[model samples]
Structures are given as C-alpha cells and as structure tokens.
Target: MKTKTVYCLSGLLLGLLTACQPSDSNLKNQNVALQLQQKALNSTLGYDLVESLTVEVGPRLPGTDKDIQAVNWAVNKLQSLGFDKVYREPVQVPVWHRGQAHAAVTSPYTQSLVITALGGSVATPEEGITADIVRFNSLADLKQAAPESVEGKIVFIDHKTERHQDGHGYGKTAPGRSQGAAAAAQKGAVAIVIRSIGTDSDRLAHTGMMRYQEGIKPIPAAAMSNPDADLINNMLKRSDKVTLQLFLSPESQGTATSYNVIAEVTGSSKPEEIVLIGAHLDSWDEGTGAIDDGAGVGIVTAAAKLIQDLPQKPARTIRVVLYAAEEIGLVGGKAYAKAHQHELHNHYIAAESDFGAGRIYQLDWNVNEAAVNALQQLTVEMADIGVMPGNNEASGGPDVSMLPALGVPVASLRQDGRDYFDWHHTPNDTLDKIDPAALAQNVAAYAQFAWLMAQSEIILRPVAEKQSQ
Candidate 1:
C-alpha cells in the first residue's frame, strides 16, 4: 500500500531551515514505523530467507561455483520481492581451495588431531613435514624464541579465545591466527598450528584467513580444536620429544568474478539521499554459512522487504547490499566505498548485520555532533526489542565499517554475540544453530531502524561539513 502523499525532500531545503521536516508527516511516519516494528517482531521471514539460502546454495566460498549461484539467487530473490530497483556491481576476488588437511602426533603419543587449513595458505609436501614439536603459549612467545631452537620443528601457538557478549574476545586472539604463520616462519619453523580462535571446547577446528609477510618464508598454517590444543599441551609436558605429521593441500587457482548484489526501496521524495543497510553474501567453505553470514543476508533483506511493502514510501531511499567476498578481507565493502567515492556525501546513513542471528540488544551510531539528537526517536522505538542506546563509537560492522571513513554516517545494532564464535568458522555453523525467534528479533530491530532512518528528518552531516571523499 503506497502512501499517496509524498513528503518534501529535507536535504533540498536544509539550508533554509534547521531540521526542516513537516510535523504531520513525521508523526505519520512514526505510526508506520511502530507498525513495521511489530510486524518484524512477529514474523519469521528472516529465518525463511536464511533457510532457503543454506538449503539451496549451501556454502558460498568466494569465487566458488556456489558463490556464483548465490549471486544469481540474490538477484532472483530481490526481483521476486518486487523491489523498485535491483542490480549488481562486479568485484574481483581471489579463489582458494580448502582441499584437505591432516594433523597427527606421531611420537610420544600417537593420536590424530582435528585441524583445518587457514585460508590462503600453501600446500605442504606430499609426504608432509614430520618434525619435532615446539610449543609456544602465545604469539609473543613465538616471536621471542631463538631461531636455532625453532628451526626444523613444528610451532604450535596454544592461545585460547575468550567468550563475551560483544564478541570482543575473537578480536583479542585473532592476531595469533593471522600472524602465527609469519612469526613461526621467522623462527625457522616448518609449519604452524594455532588453537582455534573459538570459545567452544568441541573438536571443531575454526578456519579463517591468514597473512604472510614479504620476504618471510611462507609456511603451511592451520588451527587445531581447543581440546586438541590442550591435548598437545599436555603431551609436551609429559615427554621431552613429541612429533607431528602435517599435510595440507589448499591451493590458489587465480582469481574469479563476483558481484555485490544491490536492491533498493526508492523513496517517494528524497530519493537522492540514501539509507543503506548491508550484509556479506560470501561465507567460509566449512559449513552451510548459516550463522557466519547467511543469517545476516536474511536479516537485512527481510528488514528491507518489510520497508518495501510499507503503504507509504519513506523520505529517503532504503538500499540493501548483499556484499561479495567479505569473508576474505572485506573486498566488496572496500570496492563499494571506492566506487561510490563521488557520492559518499549523498549517503544519509548506513548499517550492517554481519554478526550472527541474535537478538539486538543495543543501538549505536557514529554521526556528526549536531545529528545525534535526530536518532533519539529511533532509539526509543527500539526499546520494544530490548535495545538501548549505545556509545557513539560504533563501526557499523565488518563490511559497513568501510563507509564511515568515506564520510558516510553509520550505525550498528549490536547483537548478542556470546555464542557467535563457537560456530563462527567451523563445520557447526548451520541452520539449526539459528533460533527463529531470535532471528525475528533482529529483523524487528533492523526494520524499525531502517524505516525510521528513512522517514525521520535525520541529519547525517552538519552544515559545517565540507570535505569530500
């Protein structure tokens, strides 16, 4: 039901009036926003979308056949949903194969270990490296080790990741996975294995991207389960000599084409000004990618779908971007920022839902000083979902984090991430892990936020702002 009365463009007459907006239309928008929030809270549309994605497309590792299928799926879904605009922008992404990984203790205590290769790592020799083990409790200890001692050995960094509501714990121990290979190679190690950067004690190895330094010896890197890491730690204490046979066959097969799928609900009046929300379309090879990002795609799309079906068109456009290759290194996010450099100022505000399907507990934003009060009503509307106003230092999530620096204001609806890392990059990240009710709660928050942001007389930038990307 499209509203017949289109409101005036606030961006067009901002100079003439501070917070220029029709009071009657503002109140009407609030009434619609509250209705949208209620609809979202009671709907399982988000869960249905994610279920379709995981079941139909499965895992969407960037550049894989499934990744291409996912792009096609997104286009069809957006078109089927009857959005005003649907399109895609090409993005070049590197292709890597997980192949196979095997790790086992050959000496002292012979036992197989659960492990997965870190993304972008090289394959080991066919025979694999069978060497003595050298354990380090942390990355710092590895860096300080004597070269002679680490030479001709397998380095194991047994650092453990903690659990927290905000998922800051993953950030804390992520360095060991990202830099462990480089540090181990510098100490003259043949290979490296780190404790999985997850809070779970289960025997599931968490896989993620890793980096190698220039001119440093590149070595095979992998992560062992927390229990396996603990097993190795105990093995080291009991015996003077412990050996592991490692074999990983992951390899890069050049680059491939991917796309950032874009869909929009065009505003009736202020169409030039945009209210953007996004989630990564790509996921790890391990699981169906349900929790890592399938849930995110569903959440944002469901939110936008609700807005699109609204009786009255919002004042600002609502754009939903399902980004490509975000799992590797935020490729789509960086590409979007660079491609839209000329119009960054035109973006009214943005948000992203890359965290797992969880209840949104807080609303956070990073707007200019004068624009802060414009969000008060939006924050109050979020109260029904148990969300409170958070600090202004929000990064808008992994993918959306790229826009703010390019001068686009941003917001983050912080989810309950306490159990996120447990299934983050493991085989356990599947549809069953997501609760429909919790997913609905996320949709409720996102729909209310996006609808209100588009309808309200929000100021993304103060009159004093002049710098452009």
Candidate 2:
C-alpha cells in the first residue's frame, strides 16, 4: 500500500511541474512580444502627427471652419494610416467667438493689462465698462463679501495656481475661473476677473470655460495674465481705490455642427468587445493646441497605428475616438455617452490622453475589483518604461469622464503636468512645447497597454454577485 501511494504522489508532482513550465514559457514569450512592440513605437510618428495637426489644421475650435477641417483631416489621416474603419459622428456644439479683448488700469496707475475672455462669457457694452476695482484674495473671500460692497465694482478674484506634477493645483484654483463670475454676479459685481489658472508667471492669459447659473445674469468674465494680476495686486497696495477699463466683444452664435472622429482596428476574435482610447480634437482658439490636446491625438493615434501593424489582429477591437468641444465642457463626451448608451457595457476598457506630451509616471484604473490582478500584471510589464501603479480612483480624462460614471472600466496614464497649465489654453501651446522623445515615450506606453488589453481575455467588467462568491 505504501509503495502504491508513493507512485501516485510522484505522478502528481511530475504533472504539476509540466503545467508550470508552459505557463512560465508563455509569460516569457508575452514579455518578448511586448518589448518588441514598445521598441517599434519609439519613432517619430507621434511627433509628426502633432506637427501635422498643428501646422496643417491649426486651432480647431468647435463649430468653426477650422473645426470642420480638423474632422476631415482626422478621417483622411486615419484611413491613410490603415484603420479598418474610420468615420465621424455628428455633435452639436455651442459656438462662441472671441472678437477683441482689452483691459487697462485707469486710476492711481495707468497700465495696459493682458486679458482673454473666458468661454461662454457675455460681451461688455460697445463703450465698455470702467469701474473701481474690488479685490478678493480668493473665491472664498469673494463669496463672503457683502453685495453692497461688491456692487458697481469689477471684482478681482486673486487665486494663484500652484505647480505640481499631478496637476491637482488646477482643480484647486479652477473653481474661481468656472464659477467666479456667477458668484460675483450674485454679489452684484459688474464684472469678474480672476488670475489665470496657470503655473507660469508669463504675460499670457489662459482662457477656459466659465458658467453662469440659471437665475444669475451672465457677466463679463476674463482671466488676467499672472504678471498683470501681480501688477494689479501691487497697485492696490498703495491706494485704497483702483479703477480699470475692460472690453470684450465675444458672442455666442447659437448651436453649430461638430463631429467626433472615430477609427478602429477590428478584432480577430471578440470584435464586439472594445478597447477605447480617446483625445479631444477641439482646442481653445488661443493656440495650435499642441500641448493641450494635439499631443494627445498624436499619442493615441500613433499607438493605434502601431497596433494595426502587428502581424495578427488583437482579440478585441481597439477604437480611437477624437472628441470635439472638450475645452468648453466635454460637449462631445456627453453626446457620445447619450448616443451609445446601449453599447456602453461592451466597452471593455477606456482611456484618454489629454494632459500633454509629458512622460507617463503613474497609471491608475477604475476597473472592477476582479480585474485588479490583470492591472497589476500590466503595471509589472510597464515598469520598464517608468510607469508605476496608482490608486484605483481614476477619472480617465475630461472627455471620457462619463465612461467611469457609467461603470465602464477606465484607466489613466497620468503624465507629468508640472508645466502643462503654463501653456494649456494660451498661445504658447504650440508644437514647440512638446518634446519629441517624451512624445515617443508616451506612444510606447500607450501602445503597450492598449495592445495588452486588446489581446488579453481578462474580464475587466465587474463580476456578478454569484460569480464573486
């Protein structure tokens, strides 16, 4: 009896060893394939894409001629790049034109100040508005001020944005830009000006979206360049009352047609399942939108192009979506969610590259708890490229925020955004701001992860209750 038991144990041990050998060999093969793919993506394709978008189709503000040109360009470029299917989905976008903007200190000190109208801001009268300046250290201060004190005054919300690699400072300071006008309007201020939500101290004022609440009347809102804000602060130190003249001729031209450009590399097996990668196509009219989102379009497109060049198709389709009108409030993203409500469940994974051309340092996911192991393995594979794992609380990007909210798994390849806001919405956001080598790294990282997700059979969706137990 003892001899028979010993023989059975030996057989079981041999079988287990044989099973582990193939698993190890398969892992080694996967690593080799990933490395080769990464090497191939470290090329000039990403930079060239950015250059083409910026130079050929400059400033693609939604609903404008340039916006239509950009959509057409994207469709042609994607088709030329060998995408199996390239198409455009129509989206309705609000058109706001920035005509002429100017500001000057009138009393106590006379100096021209650099300013840009915030998106959705109402225009001042033809003669413009000249009023005594009332300064608040921050939005909180402005909110606490009495209506009588703020009435008949140009309220300046002076909140300075800090620089950080993760860009948390923008969120901290951006409230003053987005809601400051409404808050000040509630306090009876004639207009509102906030220090630009930027990291640089340059004279370029960043322009972004601001909202007016339903009940509160819209007011003229603008962002003063950091240096100009400093000038205003310095002048206020010497005198109790400072006056300023402000003029902006921006106007809303009602609704206009825009498009979301989509291209796909169809899957060999589960073609219905999707791995979606996205970037916003529309940019602020201030610059070429290179660092703000042209880099993003470049990175994702280049990555998808590399995947399409692979010898065999991946298991799931890889779809690249170029969103429209992201600067004003994710107009394209919301439209997409509403249009594709039924298919949202099949979106296996989604990610967006909108930060800049900065090198990726961290990867965060909003995937199911069951897929944590798959994400951990991906991080291990990405460690060679300097990408570390981050917490699971990921927002993806501005354009794809709705995906995570709908329970579609999303990932965030966080870039070093230390200097992104400095050139974000200003004329400084040109192709010169992107580093070719950094852009290549971004492509490599995105390609590797996107390819892995496309090929793997890992279930990224949340497990059912019965399956979890």
Maximum-TM-score candidate: 1
Candidate 1, which segments miss by more than 4 Å at Cα? 1-22, 462-469
Which one wins on lDDT?
1
Segments of candidate 2 deviating more than 4 angstroms:
1-29, 463-469
Clashing residue pairs in candidate 2 (N, C-alpha, C atoms within 3 angstroms): none
**Cα displacement (Å) at residue 342, model 2:** 1.3
Summarize candidate 1's per-residue lDDT along 169-234 as a digit string, tens digits.
888789999998998898789999899999998899999999999999799999999999999988
lDDT of each: 0.87, 0.85
Error of 2 at 286 (Å): 0.7
Return the lDDT, model 1, position 74. Answer: 96
Task: Provide the clash count, candidate 2.
Answer: 0
